[model samples]
Target: MLLSSLYIIGITAEAMTGALSAGRRKMDWFGVMLVASATAIGGGTVRDILLGHYPLGWVKHPEYLVITCIAGILTTGIAKWVIKFKGVFIRLDALGLIVFSIIGTRIALEMGLHPVICVVSALITGVFGGLLRDLMCRQTPLVLHEELYASISALSSILYLSLLNGDVTQTYATVITLTVGYLLRMAAVRFKWRLPNFHLESETSAH
Candidate 1:
């Protein structure tokens, strides 16, 4: 029940973010809904395809799709408010990442997947939606450039799996992972912590 509620919140938040991206591109309402749905559910769709999990989440629960569309349209009306409170969105995104990661991990575990596959599933579920949103918006994908985004997702999955292995209750494991993952993401943003960049300067210009 708790996970279901958090999953709804995560999709709503993701949808709003996608709406903002659509607005930045000056897209019409239909485009906003398209991007919003993609941003909210694309990750799960991809994960399901890869895992051969029948019946995607949104397909099984069409209300999830409806909720995302409604949230996107609402965001259009409150775009200014959302932009003004950037910190709120940042926090929401962090929460959503953890929530999505936990969901992914849980699904993989239920399917009896290997631990590493579960981690990969979590990473894809937590990050690919944003990747799709960015690609649609013609923006650089944040997961590719941001501080510890995918890493946090992987870490969250690993932590959750570890806790389960250590005989922790699922609820407690989830709460612990969510708290730690959210804080780590926020701290990464606060401290500008990032993986090393690989840049190659043009030799012709140097010459």
Candidate 2:
């Protein structure tokens, strides 16, 4: 599966970043592996659980899980290099987000789920891994306050679905989605594009 191959790339890249995070916190080897696994597979796991999908990807192919763990360990030795080349990880993460979204959308579509559910699935797949990583590392959830992360995932899912619905070839739809999604994310990061955040200046309730 095209998505499966991209999924492996995404997990490997995500695991490297997660391992970098662990190093920043001075975590032990076990902590690096745990964070890496969660950051790489946590979103898909959450999405599967919510959609009641069985035989999770890692469960069906445990090698992928092992890959993430190994990636984490390797990062410990390459921590300085990883941190210095953080921009590379940013690009990988952008690509990973699109890959995860497309995969999630396709999964729900395969299950005959509603379009809305498919979009939600994409969102969960793209964002939850970062969310889980942040929670574990005691850092702020960047998705909530940073660039148009979740929105990009939603847009990619919807656009991909639209192309497919319009009878476009699966190959074209995937290629176009990957290109557009990747550029949009890079632009968002460059410009610091962010969704409007809600701020409360009062303690009063609507009641």
Model 2, position 182: C-alpha lDDT score: 95
- The C-alpha TM-scores of every prediction are 0.96, 0.95
> Number of clashing residue pairs in every model?
0, 0
C-alpha lDDT score of every prediction, in listed order:
0.95, 0.93
The most accurate candidate by lDDT is: 1
lDDT of 1: 0.95
Q: In lDDT terms, how accurate is model 2?
A: 0.93
On TM-score, the candidate that comes out on top is 1
- Position 129, candidate 1: lDDT: 98
Report the C-alpha lDDT of model 2 over 1-207, residue by residue, as the tens digit: 777788889999989878878888899999999999999999999999999999898999999899999999999998889879989889989999999999999999999999999999999999999899998999998789998999999999999999999999999999999999999999999999999989986876776
**Any runs in candidate 2 off by more than 4 Å, and if so which?**
202-207
